[model samples]
Each structure stands twice: as structure tokens, then as C-alpha cells.
Target: MKKPLIDMKNIRKTYANGSLEVEVLKGISLTIDQGEFVSIIGSSGSGKSTLMNIIGCLDTCSLGEYLLDSKDINSYTEKELAIVRNEKIGFIFQKFNLLAKLNCYENVELPLIYRCMETQERRERVLKSLEMVGLSDRLKHRPSEMSGGQQQRVAIARALACAPPLILADEPTGNLDSKSSNEIMNILIDLNRKGVTLVLITHDNDIAELAHRIIRISDGEITSSIDCKRGM
Candidate 1:
């Protein structure tokens, strides 16, 4: 059997301020397999953001083992972590985070360009990713010209263009309307169906329930984890 895509053990995070050390995460351990859609739901001040930062390689835990794609990420240097973030993981934010001056195609192609991918392959990835999000026709349109749902789709396309093994989405639908939220969620579900490993950070239970597994966090610890078994 293939090893799980994410394997974390006894994870802990703490922040130090002068003489005070505040523990933000307390002994969190979880494993997510490849192709799994998992949601981590927590309210404000729950330490979920800190956990997300650690999972995304933007921060490290004070104590614990975190293996992503079977590699021990906690052992990597800052530069190595940056490379992992750029080449192995794709990130989607609540804000679309697209350049206002760049059109849809250009926005999606930006990461590939940074990777110095050959032009032909870069074009193929951008076009294929846009097609996946049903935005192939909006290639030349700017984010200002699209609806909220469309802009989020473009964001998803940008993440997909990297062909990374993991996708980290933080409140991806937070800025959209109900219709647009549903649209974005459905697109995410479809992507998971096609074998993308996605970890969604959200506070909305209704939105969290859409994922196959729901992990609830509170007071810097995991309160509960439910396997919906709703069929992946």
C-alpha cells in the first residue's frame, strides 16, 4: 500500500513573548491519505490558523513530526521549506490573490513561469487547469471583469496549474456569495474526485460537512474527528 500523503504526530506549536510562552497547539496528530478531502473547522482564536501555517510549511511546530509526501518537513531548512511550498504544494486563499493587471491566463501561468517551466508545457498546464475549472473561455478576461465565482475559479485554476500533490485552501469561499460558494465547493469536490489531496480550513459547518472527513479543533487541540464515510 502507498504511504499516506500526510502523516503528523504529536504536533505542538508555541509562541514566545519575552518571558511568556503561550502554547497554541497541543499534541495534534492526524493522517490524510492521498485523494482525501479533509476539513479542519475551528472558530476564531482556536489555533487553527497556526496549525494551517505549520501544515503549509510556512511555520514549524515547536515539537512534533510532520511528514508530507513521506518526507519529514520539520527537518528541512527554511530555503528547503520555501522550495517545498513552491513546487510540492499549491495554496488557495480567501482572497483571489491574482494580480489586477494580469488577465486570467496570465494569472494561472504565473507559477509555472516562476518555475521556469518550458513555454509549451506551461501553456498546456494553464489551459488544462482553466478547462478543469470551466474557465477556458475567460482566459483573456481580467478578475475585475468576472463574477466572484468566476474569480475563485480562476484562483483554483492557478493552484491546479502547478500540478502539485497537495492543495491547501484557507476559507476559499469566504469572500463569495451563496451561489458562488456552492460553485467553488462543487469545483473542489470535483477536483477531489479526480484524486487531488485537499485540506480545507473553514469555520462553517455547512461547508465543512461537504468534505469526506471533518476534524474539529478547539483551544489549541483536536476536539473530534469524524469520518463521514460518505464515500470518497
Candidate 2:
């Protein structure tokens, strides 16, 4: 049997504001396998973002066991975690998060630059990723020069350039029009079909329905998880 790609056990996160204490996660446990497309849906302040952060390795749980690819991530040092984040996972945000000054190709190549990849290899990977998103012709355009949908595509291309096994997207389609949203979702679906595991965080039911499985959260706990074979 193929082991689960992500195994999270009894995870917990808490924050304090003076005398007030907020518990964001109440012992959450989840397991996601390779090639799976999952959506995490929840209301505001329901800990969905916190969970996303933990899953993306951007933050650690106050208590719990998190294993990525069968290796315990809790034991990794900050530097090690940085490497894991860079090489194993890709992230997309609601705001597109592209550098304003850099052109499409340069923005996509940023990750490779951080990893100190050779210039030629970086260029090849960037171009391939851009091509995958059908944005090869827009490589020279800056963020301000593109529409919201185009900017998001560039962000997706940036995420893909590293060839990470896992992609964590937070409200990826929130800023786009219905047509653009569908386009981005189709891109994500195609990527998953090609064997990239994806975990999407969103409040929109329509967007969540695109995944093969859905996990609903409320009050910092998983309320239910349903398998939607229809692939909405």
C-alpha cells in the first residue's frame, strides 16, 4: 500500500491575547494520500487558516504530530523546515502575491533563485512552468500589466516551477471573476489529474466542490469529511 503523503495527528494550536486565550485547533487529525485533491472549508476564525499554515509548514502546531512523506516534520530545525518548505511544498495565496517589479518569468524563477539553482536550469524550469499554464507569451509582463486572472496564473506557475509534490492553495480563486475562477480551478484540476497532490482552503462551496474530497471544519474541529466522486 502507498503510505499517506500527509499524516497529522491530534494537532492543536492556541494563541493568547493578554487575559484572553483562543484555541484555534482542538486536536485535529487528518491523513491525505498522494494524488488526492482535498478541500478544507470553514467559516472565518474557525482555524482553517491555522490548519493551512500547519499543513504548509509555515507554522508549527502547539501540540501534535505532523509527518510529511512518512517523516516527522516536528523534529526538523528551522533551516531544515525551510528546505522542506522550499523543495516539497508549493503555496498559492488569494492575493496572487507576485512581486510588482519582476516580470512573469522572473517571479516564477524566484524559488529557484532561493535554492541557488543555476541560471540556465532556472530559466528552463520557469519557461516550462509558464508554458504549462499557457502563459508563455506573457513572460515579459509585470504584475500590474496583467489582469487578476493572469496574475493568479503567474502565481500558479511560480508554485509549479519547483516541481513540488504538494500544493497548498488558500482562496486561490477569491479575487477572480467567475470565468477566471473556473479557468484557475480547471488548471488546478488538470494538475491534480497529472499526479500533483493538492489541498485547497476556501470558504466558497462552489470552489470546494471542485475537489475529490471535502473536509468541513467548525469551532476548530473537523465537522465532517465527504468524498464527492462526481468532482464538482
Candidate 3:
């Protein structure tokens, strides 16, 4: 069997006030294999966001182990974590985070800049990513010139431009209409079919149903994990 892409064991996170401490994650553990599409469903303040941040390497767990491709991340320094995030994970937010001034192609090209890829290589990747999302013709359009759905597509393209092994989307369809949400979900499913591992956080069951696996959280703990392939 292929090795898991992500292996998190007994993960825990806590925040502190002056005289009180709050535990956000209560020993959550999970393993996600390569090319798998998984959704985390929970209500607000359910620790879903904290878990996503940990998975994306944006934050660290206060305890337990997190291994990405067999490399333990708890020991990594801030700079190392930054490198890992840039090279191994792609992030999409509820708000389509795009630069207002840069055109679509330029926005997609931004991640590659940090990697210091040559100009030609960056251009090729940007174009290919844009084409993958059916936005090849909008390469020159700025964020303000596009609709919300188009902007989210641009965000996806930007995420893909890095060619990262894992994509972490936090409420990706939250800002779109039902039609646009369907379109975005279809694109995500297509990407998963093409072998990009996806981990998304959503409150909508309809959105979660699209994933092959669903993990539900409540009160900062994983309450259930359901494999949905039979239903699919």
C-alpha cells in the first residue's frame, strides 16, 4: 500500500488567557493518503479552523505528532515550516485572496516567485494552471474585473500554480451562489480525480458530500468519520 501523505497522531492545541486556559483540539488524530479528497465538517468554534491551520502548517500543535510524507513537522523551525508550506501545501480561503492590482496570470505566478523558478518556467506553470481551471482567456483580467466565481477560480489557479501535493481549502464555496458553488465543487472533484490530494473545511453538508471521506467535529473533538464511497 502507498504511504499516507499526512499522518497526524494525538494532535492537541490549547490557547491561554491570563488565568484560564482553553483547549481547542482534544487529541485529534487522522491519516490521509495521497490523491484522497476529505472534508472536515463542523460548526463555528469547533476547532475545524485550528485543525486546518495545523494541516496547512500555518500553526503548530501544542502536543502530539504530525508527519507529512514521513517527515515530522514538530521539529521544524519557522523558516523550515514556511518552506514546507510553500512547497508542499496550497491554501484557498473563503475570501478569494487575490491581489487587486495584479492580473490573473500575475497572481497565479506569485507563489512560484518565492521558489525562485526561472521566468520561463513560471510562465508555463501559470498558463497551465489557468488553463486547468478554464480561465486561460482571462489571464490578463484583474480581480475587480472578474465575478466572484471567476475570482475564486483564479484563487484555485494560484493554488495549483505551485503544483503542491496537497490543497487545503477553508470554506472555498462560502462566498459563491449555489450555481457557482456547484461549479467550484465540480472543479475540485476533477482536480481530485487527476491525483491532487484535497482537504477542505466546510459547514455545508452538500459540499462535504462531494468528498470521498467525511470527518465531523464538535466541541473541538472528532465525533465521527464516515467513508462515503458507497453512497457516491
- Which stretches of model 2 miss by more than 4 angstroms? none
TM-score of each: 0.95, 0.97, 0.97
Candidate 2 per-residue lDDT, tens place, 6-97, comes to 99999999999899988999999999999899999999988999999999899999999999999999999999999999999999999999
lDDT of 1 by residue, 1-232 (tens): 6459999999999899899999999999989999899999988999898988999999999999999998999889999998898888889999889999999999999989888899999999999999998999999999999988899899999999988888999999999899999989999998888889999999888889888899999999999999875544
lDDT per model vs. reference? 0.92, 0.94, 0.93
| Candidate 2 clash figure, as a count | 0
Compute the lDDT of residue 136 as modeled in candidate 1: 90
Q: Report RMSD (Å) for each prediction in the order shown.
A: 1.4, 1.2, 1.1
Predicted structure 1: lDDT: 0.92
lDDT of 1 at 137: 96
Query: lDDT score of model 2?
Result: 0.94
lDDT of 1 at 79: 91
What alpha-carbon RMSD in Å does predicted model 3 have with respect to the real structure?
1.1
The lDDT-based order of candidates, best leading, equals 2, 3, 1
> Per-residue lDDT for 1-232 in model 3, tens only?
7579999999999999888989999999999999899999999999999999999999999999999989999999999999999999989899999999999999999989999999999999999999988999998999999999999999999999998999999999999999989889988898898989999999999789889899999998999999986236
* Candidate 1 clash pair list: none
Give me the overall lDDT of model 3. 0.93
